[model samples]
Target: MSRVVLRRCIVRGRIQPARTSDVRAPGPRATAPNSRDGATPRHSASHDNRSRTEVPMVSSSVGGVKSPRFFYGWVIIACVWVANFVTVSINPLVFAFFLDSMSVDLDVKRSTLVWGITIRMISGGLFAPYLGRIVDRHGTRWPGAVAGLVVGLVLIGFAFTSNIWIMFGLFFISGLTGFSIFGGNMLTMVPPASWFVAKRGRALSIATSGQLFGTATFAIAAALLIEAFGWRWAWAIFGIVAIVGVVPPYALLMRRRPEDMGLLPDGATSLPVVEVTSAVASPTPTAPVASATHREEPDFTVAEAWRTPVLWANLAATTLLMVAISPFLLFRNHYWTTLGFSPTLIAIGVALDPFSFAIANIAMGFFAERVPIRFTGVIGGVWRGFGMLPLTLGMTWPGSVVLHNVVWGIGSGTTSVFQTMMIPDYFGRTNQGAIRGSITPIMVTVSALGAPLGGYLLDAGVSYIAFFWGIFLAVTVASASFFFQKPPKHAPAATDPPTRMPTST
Candidate 1:
């Protein structure tokens, strides 16, 4: 009978047994060369055999099969793409179409209606930290699925609600579920970030670009539905779409981390090996190996990351961007309408915006892989700032509407990629959910004021032209802050022991 020899090896950063057959029967223990003494006695056969038979490590692939050519990470990205499309389309994107109709039907001030968005933001912001911890402890699957259900139901509830307070309650629920988990970039962004490290920027770009396409698709669809059926029916239909698109894919396909699946990030096929010493064998230390294409990132705890200035800078810039962009998105259609642009022209502008956004997104994906994220953010902000200049001309220049959308779309697309990548890139993915969640409250507190503030300003006779100029200023400041956001140096705590790879001699 062949003798089985078991040695411990590190595979893809996890400890597992490497078994090999030896023809020789058990005999005197062999002596291995030791660095200090030149020879060391091996453990007895009983010790070796007992350790070998205790537990069998599960193989990542069955029957020694190679990993598939297609990476499962891309499948995860696809699910995120679908989730982004449905979640965003049902809320802020499509909600713009319903604003006027809902305001008129419910007999509420436009600002009162817009307060729904503010409530959603505030509620989401409050829930984010707790949700982040949950995501860290658990995974995105159940949370995402449940959030999708709540979002879908919330949209459907909008159909039956006439009381503004009830609408506010629904908005609160939607914010807590949809805004925090699915639509607000947490669940959608975190999955791809967790899945791919080297290809993170590109992956996030592809994942978030779904919002642009969803915008293009749903804008026209919303207009058509509102024209044919009414705003109430349109809300009901989008509810159905959100449910159908978001739930199954997230529940079925989502996973926590690549390590959990015995896989490496970015679909890397080769397993890194690290040697560990045991009592039975002489010390044969080996450094942890990583794939050529993969760069191992430093893991920082949330508490540690908070000590760095980069996180605060990014937080400031993100908050400013939200303040500028949120109102612009919420008021785009309304602003154009007030300028005497026809409904059809406004609809065309809304639909065409995503095309430019898609082009910029694809371009940014390429650049993000090669360039500094700070540079990309700076450029996007400047481009977006200039884009607002078109709106200053207003109805006198009929083409200004489309020009603004196109130019701003490109800028927004570029910034979107940068925003998704910045935190994870600097902080690493170990505590990503908690870290991102921790900052959401600050961002939401400031940005949540945009919609209602815009409505109030406009209602108080503040010129939309002046409002646009103010947004340009905010964009300028936000973009400038990115220059200060270099990656933070990680300092490992003294008490924390370094992870050691398990090995058998």
Candidate 2:
């Protein structure tokens, strides 16, 4: 019996080895650190359980993007687009509406009213970078929702401001609301770039239309509102309408990116939705990995974008334009009062500025592909050169004001719309947010100073009509600057038929 038991033990020992290994376990990483202790790790049981990393495959959305089937990205664009329209439309337009009331109620110098606009410009440009990084990490929906709340609350607060300082504070906050949410536009571009490589130009143009259309329509509507109700009530109306209109679409429509959905980008026929993971929310150097999906579009690094000569040239262009545009926005109260227009009519005119831009943007959208962007700049310069001349002469002559605006509106719209193309054109695909964000500060500062400068020039007994001519010359300098630089070597080319759009969510 003892011999038989020993034999059984011997048999059991033979059946099992000292250690076991599973083929499924991953091989060691090339760069993994070895412990100082220098013993090979005893593999954990769960180590082999999960797969390494997955690259999903998906070309088209589960359902093709039809009218009812807006791709998640497209939906986000539409929603953000409307919000953008309302934001820009209400900002400058509403200021023109409420200035006289604010002047009377607060008893401040109306020329100083540009101080409010100047403050907003400075604040908005400053906050852009911080907001941009958060979007890069998280997503657009939250930021947009938060911006709406801020805009609404500040607008409501405007109703009660008895002090100029308090009103100044609120207007600055309104700018934060306006420019901070621009991150949404960048967010939209990145994902759509992932989903629709073939039709990117058209998709971008469509997305851009919202901003254009909204500016015009919102301007007109804002004027009508200011006309019917006092500025106080206009604030209330703007706040209420934003909450009702904006909140829903953001929640339902916006997404982080297609990679989050485990799908390929741009829905290439061969590569499917691979997943925009937290890992992909960003990537580190050395690896330089990108998905076979949408991220393949030519992208630039922030450093590269800043280094480009064209970008610097464009910066020069933006500076001249900023100076030219600031006079109307910063000095609207002074502009109207000197002309003897009623506060009501000034409000009405403010509305026209954005409305004109909206129409101009749509028309310019067609020309974007057809014309060289450089030509647009030259045309805009010529218009800006002359756009404000009539208004500078004084508000007493409404015809000059109207004519100035006709050119002003067209030139302003053209210049702004053209500026919109800068991202895809020079920065290409990568780091556009950072590059664009970087420019805001310079632009805003020019605007900030330009406002007071306009007022100061008027105070100095300089003819604003002469100032307008100088501004036109500045535009010429800016337009000419574009010639100093060459196009980025790998800049994205305009597509022939345009790329296909991502499927609707």
Best by lDDT: 1
The TM-score between candidate 2 and the true structure equals 0.69
Instruction: Report the poorest 10 consecutive residues by lDDT, candidate 2.
Output: 1-10
Residue 225 error, candidate 1, Å: 0.8
- Full-model lDDT for every candidate: 0.72, 0.53
RMSD of 2: 15.9
Give the alpha carbon lDDT tens digit for every residue of 1-505 in model 1. 2223343222232334433331123333322111011111111123133222212344346433235568788988898889878776545656788888988999998888988888898888888888887887787898998988989999899899989999999998988873422224577778899888767878888887777788888898889999999998988998898888889998999988777776667765544432222343313322122222325455677887788888888888788778777778878788778778888888888777887887887788778766667777887887788788887645456698788888888888887777788767777777888888888888887788888888898889998889888888889899888766666654444565434544323
Displacement of residue 201 (Cα, Å) in model 1 is: 1.3
Roughly what TM-score does model 1 have, to 2 decimal places? 0.82
